[model samples]
Target: MDGFDETFDWVVVGSGAGSMTSALVMRQAGKSVLVLEKTGYVGGTTAKSGGVIWVPNNPLMRQAGEQDSTEAGIAYLEALAENLPGSTPEKRRAYVVESQKMIDFLLAQGIPLARGADFWPDYYDEVPGGCKTSRTVTARYFNKAELGPEWAARLRPGFVSQPAMLSEGLKLAWVGRSWKIKLLLLRIGLRVIAGKLTGKQWVSAGAALQGRLLKAVLDAGADVRIDSPVRELVIADGRVAGVIAESGGERRRIGARLGVLINAGGFAQNQAMRDRFMPGTRAEWSNTPEGDTGDMHAEMERIGAALGQMDQMVGYQMTRMPGWEQAFVKPPAQSLTGKPGAILVDQSGQRYMNEGGSYELYCQTMFERNRTVPAIPSWAIFDARFAQSYPIAGVRMAKMHQVWKDSGYLKEADTIEGLAAQIGVPAEALQATIARWNGFVDAGHDADFGRGARAYDQWLGDPFLKPNPALARIDQAPFYAVDVVPGDVSTYGGAVTDARARVLRPDGSVIDGLYACGVSSASVMGGVYVGAGASIGPSLAFGYVAARHAAGLDNSL
Candidate 1:
């Protein structure tokens, strides 16, 4: 590809983690870049995410005393995934191998970054070669002033209401434990005081991450257009050359001299796409932002770019009310049903899998069981004690919204049998299930599904609880049941890409000038939720890779 003056060297579609990184990288490499976003908001699904990035064997991991290896990461990917399109040995090696380069690139750009939570273990910590410590990093507390007033106002809020580091959030989650919580509060208080004295206003998590990238793009003089979506790709000489974007009832043809990269996210918001590809999931079942409607996916399909991973999503366990199912919310530590006195039961009122695994794993269980059982909209039963301990969603026990209760989102009763009756499940079966679960609780072990057996479960559990922190007898009065279902933090399926992040045709040849990353590309992790920030890590790496190659720079290292 030859560089053409008057046209941008690269045109990036979308404003998520991947697109922003691509724009930043190209602009930094002295290439003109343009970003087109479908919505008024810049951060696509990323703005709605918890912004820790998983990098295998990251420098921060080493500095934090975790001797993780790329080999171990490769092994973990291979062991966990099966028959995923891009999980080849070479690509997996590339993802692991490029972690440091990406980290170095962001650091060189002066992005504030530090080690994320050490307690944030890999999704499967018990498996062989699993990383038990922080291989993830987050943007350090960023002063919103870095984005200036207008841009700062547009940045999305963090996933959690708590604007603190992941480590601090983990410590602050120990609400029931007196001593540990007090100490954690004292540490946070000191940090807050120091910040006030310095007059540096700080924000953490996804907002900080996107703000840094957005700032880098803006500072590098990249052009960004909001409320603009690429509706069609202009293909010349069997290569993508430009895009026709529509805005305000008019269309404009924007030429790209280098390449067109579509990081416009997945079909999570499209019900037709979900039904055809990912079954049993509707638009209401995902945590993806409103703009991810798979419009670009449809546009690219017309150009013969091969796509896969439609059957997969980066699934999450979520609670949904009846009519408000489409607007799913991520579970805070308080809503995690694996906590003491809470249990998940299918329509038949029976436990299926361990309630206390990774959220994605929990979703996998629901999907697998739904093939034969009524597990899609499972019931999460908890005693009054559990509700009193933590907020369900954002509502405390006393604050359970009237609309939520009236709309059949929550079923409440003074006894488990009565609660089961209200929810239309078998009272006898639920009673038996509770009796069996209570036996396991009293015996200090889960004899049925091993709920509290794994380190991953205990990582989110209360340390001070006896027997098992994730288990408690549900013998208390005023039982409650909420409808929990499958949801996604992001979709893993998208356009297939090669080693260089170029979109591949059905016959496996590159589409010449087309590339993709983030949720728009088939996940490099093979749809396996490897660890915290897994999706963003590959997005950053391949976004960098796509830009470098499109600019005629060496990407073969």
Candidate 2:
């Protein structure tokens, strides 16, 4: 052993939104805190994700003149998660109440958030209590130049490159006459080029957010140990006493007199765990640095922590580069929501669910369909015209055509039947499905699945198209299909915790001095995702709750 010993009042493991929030909360409460990260860099998957945090009825929403109530938000989630496990009344209440507290705390800490004014749309928008609001908040794009040399290098390069503001990659295919987004993109592009020309590095959204959080923690005199993986939780007399960590190939014991907060992410990268928990899932995750091995869950389980909602995991159907292991292809919003895009079909070439649904629902539907049929190698078919008009993810349609073909994704066919045949689907069934879809397009209404029928779905669809930009017939020729596999942003299930953000035993008592949040804890959303920022909202809230409760802040509840 190299002989390194450190102690703090609170120790937070994992540097995602949850861990940062917890650490910051504890710091604000006048507690000395230390954050231990396994990876060389801080910021977990959150630094790689869309930084928008969804908080219904938040100050930002109210300032934008959007009316939302806690009851309405709960109603919306309840309707979507209807029969799902973990959707308890207490959990729902805690999510809403704590969410506001998180927003207030962040704002007080100089974290500026712009309202995602037009981004509201629950997966099931037609359900009761679902409405459009600027509830989601995003940070202003900060240039990596502002973070200084030492701190910038400490960040994971790829992780900070996403939630690619209109600057990095446009989320909406077209700006729809929004000069703000256009200007932002232009500014970002110029800055990136300038930085490249000068041999300087650049970072955005998730990275920027992480940098801000880290700066706040450091400013508050908190210490962080990189490449230190917490191996075991030290429990004594039914309370977490400290942690055993491996740093620099040597074991070091760090005692946390107050608590140990575990935010070490979920098991998305763990194939064995994925296979065991989410059977039949192609558990490819585009997450933070790949070292996230679900250590928090494993440690908690060893200590007899009760696990909740192990069956749930966040899912995204990803478009990947054919031969590259690290490179990924982001699918265009138009490809999923626009009229030209065909319904996603499984390996057996059968229709699964509404292709215009949110990514979470899309994954859920794909998983369910895979159980009944071979949905692993599913395809997103579209016409040449749609490809030509809209940007598909980070790549243009023409570029995507080449990349998909080269990557063994795009399957060209002169007709739908030919395409179906190539994909190993019953040609007749695919033809019939297309015919029905065309009928809906012509009638300006989707009767079966109601694609583009709701305000939220429309938010993701083309706004210029009448009736619904998301609705269109697939009668055009030169049909094309690209394979899509179920991918994930991160895993959702981890150590189970209560409303107070306290880790719970199987018998439902708090594991004193221990707290878990973020992807390291069971999602408060249950199995249904609400919108873009749902993951981060609960993460921040629960982290705050955990820190507050741990610091003995009137833990009456």
**lDDT, residue 3, model 1:** 33
**What lDDT score is found at residue 310 in candidate 2?**
75
Put down candidate 1 lDDT per residue, 71-96, tens digits, no spaces: 88778777776656655667777788
Residue-by-residue lDDT tens digits, candidate 2, 31-84:
889899998888877777766677777787777677888888778777766432
TM per candidate: 0.92, 0.91
TM accuracy, model 2: 0.91
Error of 1 at 52 (Å): 1.8
Q: lDDT (CA) for every model shown?
A: 0.79, 0.72
Q: CA shift at 293, candidate 1, in angstroms?
A: 0.8
Off by over 4 Å in 2: 1-4, 82-87, 158-172, 175-202, 285-288, 328-340, 400-403, 554-556
RMSD of each candidate? 2.9, 3.2
